[model samples]
Target: MIYKVLASILLLLVIIGGWSWTEYQSARNTLAVPGEQVSIDIKKGDSFDNITHKLIAQNVNIKPFWFKVVAMQEKATTKIKIGEYVLKGGMTAPELLAVLVSGKQKQYSITFPEGWAFKEILQEIAKNSYIEHTLTDSTIDFSALMAKLKVEKNHPEGLFFPDTYFFEKNTTDIAILKRAYDKMQVVLNEEWGKKEANLPLKSPYEALILASIVEKETGAKVERPLIAGVFTRRLEIGMLLQTDPTVIYGMGDNYQGNITLKDLRTPTTYNTYTIKGLPPTPIALPGRDAIVATLHPAAGDSLYFVARGDGSGTHVFSASLKDHNAAVNTHQRKAN
Candidate 1:
C-alpha cells in the first residue's frame, strides 16, 4: 500500500514538472507567425488582463497564463507604457514584454519644406491626423500663439526650422512648433557667430530677412550665393531691392501670379521695391543653406540678375544696367 502511494506521488510530481517545462517553452516561442506584424494600443489605466485580451484580439497567439508568468518573471507586469506599439510576428513572450517596458512607442513624421510660409506651415500641421490640434483656427492671433509657445518675438514667421520632425501619436501642434522654434534658434545663433565680416545686416534677424528673400528668389541651388551677393551689394549702395517677390508678398491676396508696374509702385511694409531697407520681418521660412548664403554672400561685382528663361532656372548676372537690360531683353524676347 505504501509503495502504491509513493508511486502515485512520484507520478503527480512528474506530471507537474512536464507541464511547467511546456509552459516555459511556450513563453520562449514566437507569439505570432513569422513576418506578421500587429499594432496594439495600450491606454491609460489598462490592466495586465486587458493587455492580454487586446493581444489575443489582434491574433497575437499569446497564451494568457504563460504570458502572465513571463511578465511576472521579468518584473514588468506594471511597467508597460501607454502608447501605440508595433509587435512583430517573430517576437517571443519575453521580447514582447521587453518592448512594453521599454516605452519606445511607434513614431510618426511631419515635414516642413524649405521656403514655406507661416501660413503654409499651419496648413501642413492641420493636415496631419496623428497630431493633436490645439489651435483650431488657422487665423489665430499671432501674438497669443507666440506667447503660448514661449517665444518673445511678436511674429512667428521664419522662427521654426524647416525639417522633418518625428513624434509619438497625439503630440500637440504647439509642442512640435516649439521644438522647431528651439532648433531654429540654436542653428541661427551658431551660424551668426561665424558670419563673414562687413555684412550690412545689423542683427541676426536681418540676416534671416535677407535669407528668406534668397530662398524665394530662385530654385537653383548654385544661385543662392549669387542672389545674396546682388542683394547685399544693393543694400550697400543704397539701391532699391526692386525684387518682385517682396512686391508679391506686400500685395498679399491681391497678387494674381503676375506683377504689374502699378503693384510695384504700391508701397507696403514688405515691399522692397518701395521700402528703403530690409523688411520688418522674414517673408518665409529660410532653410539653413539660405541663411548661410545670406551671411556669406559670394564675392562678385554683379548688381543685377534675371532668369535665363530657357527652361533652365539659371540667371544671367550683370555688373551694369546696360548689360542687365541686354540680358533682360534677350530673355524676354525668347519668352515672348
Candidate 2:
C-alpha cells in the first residue's frame, strides 16, 4: 500500500510539472497580436489586471493568467509606467512583458516661436492634449507664481525660452515652463559672459530686453546682429530708441496694427522712444540666436534702420537721420 501511494504522488508531480512547462512554452511562443499592431493607453494608477484588460480590449489575444505569472516572474508588475504604448505584429507575451518593463512612453512635442507673448504660450499649452493643464486664472497670482518658480523677476513675459520641447504625456504646463526658463537662464548666462566690451547692458536682463527688441525688429536670421548693433549704438549714445515695435507693445490691445503719432508719443515703460533705456522687462520671448546677437552685436556705425519696403523683410541701415528719412520716404512711395 505504501508503494502504491508513493507511485501515485510521483505521477501527480509529473503531471503538474508537464502542465507548467506547457504553459511556459505557450507564453513564450504565442503572439498576443498576430498580424496587426495594437495601441493601448495605460493610465496612471493602472493595475496589472487593468493593463491586461486594456490589451484584451484592443483585440490582443493575451492570456491574462499566464501574462500575470510572467510579469511576476520577471519582477515587472511594479515596473510598468503610464503612457501610450504600441505592440507590433507578432509580438509574443514575453516581448510585450519586456516592453512594459522597459517603461518607454510615447512622446509629444510643443513649439514656441520667437517673439511669442506669454499669453500665446499659455494658449498653446492649454490646447495640447498630452500636457496636463494645471494652470488657470484662479491658480495664477503673478507674485506667488514668480515666487514659486524662484524667478527673480516680477513678470513672466519673455522668461521662457522659445524652443521645441518634447515630453511624455501628463506633463504639466508649469513643468514645461520651468524647463524653458532654466534653458533661458543657462543660455543667457553663457552669452552674457561672452558680451562685447563696453556694453551698455548692466545685467543679463538688460541683454534679454535688447534681444527681444531685436527679435521683433526683423525675422531675417542674418539681420539679428545688425539690428542689435543699431540698438546697442543708440543706447551707448544716449539716443532714444525710436523703434516702432516697442511703442506698439506699449499700446497693448489698443494698438490696432497701426502706430499713429499718438502711440509713439504715448508714455509707457515699454516705449523705448519715451523711456530712453531698455524696457523694464522683456517685451516678448526671444530665441537663443537673438540673445547671442545682442551680446555680440555686429560692428558698425549705423544707428538707424527702416523697412526696405520692396516686399523684402530686410531693413536699410543708416548712419544719420537724413538717410533714414530718405529710406522711409522711399518705403512710403512703395507703400502708396
Candidate 3:
C-alpha cells in the first residue's frame, strides 16, 4: 500500500510540472524584449499565421504557433487595425496588440516661417521626409490644391498660416497644406473676435490682406505696428498705399532689378499704386504679430517711409510728401 501511494504522488507532481512548463512557454512566446523599435504592417483581413510570419521576418522574436494562440485568447483578430506601428521589445502581448489595434503612426512637425508664399511652402514640404509625394507628382499645380481647400482666389496666397504644424510621418503635401489653411482660419477667427474698434479693415479677410502687406514690407518686429499704422492711416485718408513690396509681388519671377517709376504705375491688381484699398488677396503668409498689428496698429499719423540705408533696417517715417521724397532719393534712388 505505501508503494502504491508513492507512485500516485509522483504522477501528480509530473502533471503539475507539465502544466507549469506549458504556461511558461505561453508567456515566453507572447512577451517581447525591451528597447527595440519593431515596425509591422498588417494588411486588411490578414490571417494570424501570415502576420506571424511577417513579424518573425522583421525580428519580432515571437513564435508563429504560440502567437496565434495568444491572439485568439486576446480576441485580437477584429481589433487589429491596418497601418504601420512601432512595437517595442519587452512589451507584453496585450501592449503590442493594443499598438496594432490603435493603427496610429508617429507624428512629425513641420514649421512654416513668416512671409513664405504658398509655392515656397509647397517646395519645403516636397523636400521633407515626413511629407511624401511621387517625384513626378511633387510639381503638381497648386491651383487645384487651392481649389480643393476652397480658397476664394485662384492663388492660395495668404491662406496658409505661418506656424509649426504636427502631422503623421510621410503625410501628403496636400494634407499638410490643408492643415495650414485650417490653422489660418482658426487664428483669423480668434483675432477678429478681439479686434480693436474703428479700424479701417472691413472684415477679417481684409485684415489678413493688410497683414500680408506688412509681412513683406519689413522684417522688423517692433516696426510691424508702426507699419500697420502707416498703411491704415493712408487708407483712412484716401491715399494710395504705394508700397514697394506690392510692386515686387506684381513683378513675380520676371523682376530684373530695382523697380523704376514705370513699374510703380504698372496696371496690376497687386500694384498698390493702381488699386484702391487692400489688394485682391494676400501677398505672403504673415506671422501672428503682423496679424495682431493689423488689428491694433500703433497710434500715428505718419504717411510715408523710406529705408534709412544705414543697414540697421529701421526705416525713417515722414508725415509730409516732401520729407518722404527726400529720404527716398537720399537712401534708395541714388547710386551706391
Model 2, runs deviating above 4 Å: 1-23, 33-37, 88-90
Q: List the residue pairs that clash in candidate 1.
A: none
Worst 10-residue lDDT window for candidate 3 reads 133-142
The global C-alpha lDDT for each of the candidates, from Candidate 1 onward, is: 0.90, 0.87, 0.81
lDDT of 1 by residue, 161-200 (tens): 9999999999999999999999988888889999999999
Which number leads on lDDT? 1
How many residue pairs of model 3 clash at the backbone? 5
Model 1: CA > 4 A from native = 31-34
Question: Ten-residue segment with the worst summed lDDT in candidate 1?
Answer: 27-36
Better of 1 and 2 by lDDT: 1
How much is the lDDT of residue 305 in candidate 3?
A: 90
Error of 3 at 223 (Å): 1.6
Runs in model 3 with CA error above 4 Å?
1-36, 88-90, 128-147, 151-154, 169-172, 310-312, 325-336
Q: After superposition, how far is residue 77 of candidate 2 from its true place, in Å?
A: 2.5
User: Alpha carbon lDDT of residue 283, candidate 2?
Assistant: 83
lDDT of 3 by residue, 149-207 (tens): 67766778898899888776667777777888888899998998998899989999999
Specify the highest-TM-score model's number: 1
If scored against the real structure, what TM-score would every candidate get? 0.96, 0.90, 0.82
